[model samples]
Target: MGFLSSLLGIIGFGIGLPIGLLVGFFFFVYSKPKQVQDPVVRPLEECDTTVLPDLLPEIPIWVKDPDYERAICREIRRQAEPILAEYSEKYKIKAIEFENLDLGTLPPTINGIRVYETNEKELVMEPVIKWAGNPNIILVLKLLSLQITLQLVDLQVFFAPRMTLKPLVPTFPCFANILVSLMERPHVDFGMKVLGGDIMSIPGLYQFIQVVRAFKLMKADFLGLSDPYVKLNLTGESLPGKKTTIKKKTLNPEWNENFKFVVREHQSQALQIQVFDWDKVGGDDRLGMQLVPLKLVTPHETKEFNLDLLKHTNISVHNDKKYRGTIVLELTYAPFREDSTSALSAKFDQMDSIIYRSSSNETLSKAGLLSVLVEAAEDLEGERHNNPYALILFRGEQKKTKLLRKTRNPLWNEEFQFALEEPPLLDKIRIEVLSKRTGIRFRSKESLGHVEINLDDVVRNGRINQKYHLINSKNGQLHVEIEWTMV
Candidate 1:
């Protein structure tokens, strides 16, 4: 009876445990929600939406929301600022604004960039770049200015590559990358220049942040951008609006600038040039050019770059064909910017005129009607293009006379009598001797047929029975000889 009672108790306990666990599980499954310690959803009444994102330092360049370039600049500043501030203590320089620089028909020179009118003066730019970032980041930044010419160019910057410009400005330590811009009118060429070196290199990240703080304090770009865009002085009169011209007497950079720059075109304008024998050779550096600067005489009264004649001389001819040096002035001025077209360069009145000259070497081919095929380069005679182009030049004193093209004429046996309209200053006569299949022999002491010449009083003829100097009669050759003046 005791064993049966123990067994009954165990069975009853097992049955109660399973039932209790099942009931508790069902109750827990349908229980109340568990509360979060901190609520993430903010109440609408307490939300603050007064400050705008553009006001943030990360979006400094975006003055307007839609401009893509502004957005890109902002992003660049945001990303590069941290890495730049590592080494420098002072601020990084922002962008520089160049506006209303002139491109008056004439080309400038290397030195002319110094002043507005003449390469005699130099070009100096004050930039304007507005941004909000750590002033320290300015250390890695550069503000470069390049001076250019037809042959070569140089660069100047806020700072050197590896070194700072503290000596130039004792209080400030800055560096820049001088970028030389070789401009072909509306287009700018970057491959023409050479970059100096890299900026400051810092070791730690926290130190770089301090450098950015310093850059925020320097607002140098404001100095460059404050000036207005200069307008073209058409009508020879200053427009009724703002006076853009800086007086020639004042001789200073007033309110005029441009960003894309090549070398100056006016540097050679002031030079006093004399075209002798188809070559222009100036006396000295100072007397080499003759230049006139552009300026506003009065607000209402305008002035065209009227170059009637500073000084000149003419020739009196009595024949149908005329030949003389026609002294013409060279006009050099600036264009407003890239793609800028002012009616300044219109027709013959706007183009430069050079006195016509003929030389001994430049024998223009008698082809291409209206325009002859010249050897040496001709200046901008007709309507000139705004862009730069290639020029083919030749050496030796050559005449701008008519000549035949060297064609493969093997049976040129008859004496090619070249009748010059004028007596040629002949130094050498070139003959194209050739054969179809048989090549001309180099040099043998056997004469076949020869040449005859007569220069005014001098004369010579072919030999009869003498040992013939049988030149490239076997193969082909171009025989040329110096003109002998019989003394």
Candidate 2:
């Protein structure tokens, strides 16, 4: 009986102990809240791809157009309205209607008298010229050109002009020495809030919207209509094929109404002219001249001169000591042609054309700029080639930075400008000059001081005309203009 009782008690304790422990453990665990993982958030969609149905205007005509200028303006309106909406909220200000206008205002970039138009809040210009020495460059402002209007809750209404400047240009003012002051500097914090950190403001970042606009403004054409933006002042220079004897060209009554000029009998030295022309048709003259001279056989080549050349050519005084067989020119006039051809090729039809399209009566972009742009491309043409055309571009003069092989993508024509790989540091630019079908051997050499580039139609010249009259007529000669941008 004792053995039976003991065995039974031991068995009961063994089973009951384990069961009691398990029950208590389960109750303790269940008493507390169940553990749960936190919810994750899908990151905000990218702003670039963020489809704001009301973001851009319903009319996408500007987007379809290849011109970024129009697109930028529309983008300004698209972007500005929202920012202003947010800006008003942040500053606790109401965006009021635009007001005030002055056309006789000028911003700093205007080297000469600048012509500016504004909604009394912002300044927009058709053409702005900034002379950075050597190159007299023109700038056609490609921006929304808008001014702003704000309200301080019945206290006062204010207006501001949006600035038109690149990011770095405003940051480091003294480095470039540009005419315009650092555009009303962006509150970098404000700018950062609008533009994310992923971007380093490159050349054109108006969308980052740092440009300061004006409410009251004035603009003037530093130089009026027909006033030459560039000029050649040839003062006290030597001419080719002359010494002390003055050769004279005279009109004879007996001759068939022709004027004749004669070279002196004793003078054998070549006359050289020094050309001082603007470096760029637009922008600053940051381009450095490199005279890649063709191999010269002798130290003394007969020189020639011509008037009415698009670019002013200057000839240096022939150095008698280290005489070379190359004719020297002093270039005083800058090339004005945008396309290789002459400007007269394109004629604007003044009869019927839409000038600048306006948004509001106070729109910064208006009829003025549009009026000037008309007929700019009437006569423009690309480089003509018979065979497959390949475009070549060099970031620097060195072959290392050169694009070994390039094929152009024709923009509007069969010929397209080559977009070269940017050099690690943008140091220089070199391009291959071609004269096809003109049967001319153009010689260009990059050198210092003694720089001279000559295009000679060896086969056709001498039989046709003594001067470049034939070359000019065939449109065989192309001009090169340099422009500068601070990246």
Candidate 3:
């Protein structure tokens, strides 16, 4: 009897729960308030100016923030089409066109702003931004015989970024430079629809979106023993290649080095990466090499590659089987700016009267200004007195720096300039460090060390900052910076 009573009670409770839910849902759907009023719309002139301040707290923050100004979506779309077309041509896409682009009336909101005060020529602020927008942006892509349509919907983003306006001036813009930096990883959410079906809802596709969103925040091998170093250069260039420091006695070495090169012709140029085994007493041995064509890299985009090293760039049946090793690299190419290119052209045109042409079909480069800076010297020593000064000689001109007395390390920070009618492609500059005796001595001045550098690399590469080991000196080095600018 007790079991039957418990079973009956359980049935009654289960039945009553659904009935109560139905009654509550019915009231929630059908109930109306005692007082209801339609919203009133008025013109701006009729609204009281004094009451506007009271409604500030009730209005949305995005509407009141100056940073949340409405964007001209039509102008943005017009400007973006040409850039998209350029990228499409680079990737060999048949066609890429915008089907529809409307960045709705909504704008990003600034939740908070923090300003920093410093005794410098800069203004810094950090703003927390949140944006949930309904934008209709559709893209149509064609590849060979296939055509694809992509639609973006329900986009959201949240980020905190620091902005800096530096070196305030009395000019129109007031700031010389504006810098923007992210404090942390940004959160982005969006839905992509392809062919009117939501692709984000598909299995495994959502993970791809997460992977791409996370990407926004964005090697070696050896035989028994080797001290590996890498040399990087662009092919078809006359300048010397950049190199990494040697890692000693390791089977696997990681030289996380950064290098920049001026690329004149991206379609014909290739980056040559060569690895070598450094030796203390003898010449370095070539370990392996690889070539990365510049055309394969998109401008201003970083791409990673784990490439297999080869004996030479000529890949053959024999070279394919050789297991040299693999190299990991991040490559980015930036195209030359139009203003700089035009300025260089104008300089060349101005120096056309002085341009020299040889009988061997060789033409001299245009005139350029050469700058030499004697920064400092390290570990320099003299026999008599360590009162060291630097003497710079270029062509027929000579310059000298102030002598520092009784110091093994001296910082001159002196700069010298040379005006020339043509590039010094085959010329060389000599820098000698000499020490002068303060008191009476047999020899007033003595040579500490001297170095001669060829100007070919400086002219080709535009600028070079290097520490050169002094000739005929033990553990002495000279720091120098050279810059060549077309006049």
Best model number under lDDT: 3
Model 3 lDDT per residue over 145-236, tens place: 77757777767776778999999887645788889998656655464455421111111000000000000000222445777778887788
Query: What do the candidate models score in CA lDDT, each in turn?
Result: 0.24, 0.24, 0.68
Q: How many clashes in each candidate?
A: 74, 69, 0
Model 2, 211-314: lDDT tens per residue?
11111111112331111111111122222211111112211101111111111211231222221213225532211111212111121232222212212223
Tell me the lDDT of candidate 1: 0.24
Which 10-residue window in model 1 sums to the lowest lDDT? 206-215
Stretches of candidate 1 off by over 4 Å are 1-13, 28-487
Which stretches in model 3 have alpha-carbon errors above 4 Å? 1-71, 119-123, 143-146, 159-189, 196-275, 278-487
All candidates: CA RMSD (Å): 32.3, 26.1, 31.4
At residue 150, what lDDT does model 2 achieve? 17
Which 10 consecutive positions of candidate 3 have the poorest summed lDDT? 205-214
Candidate 2 wrongly placed segments (more than 4 Å): 1-13, 21-487
Model 2, CA-based lDDT: 0.24
Whose TM-score is greatest here? 3
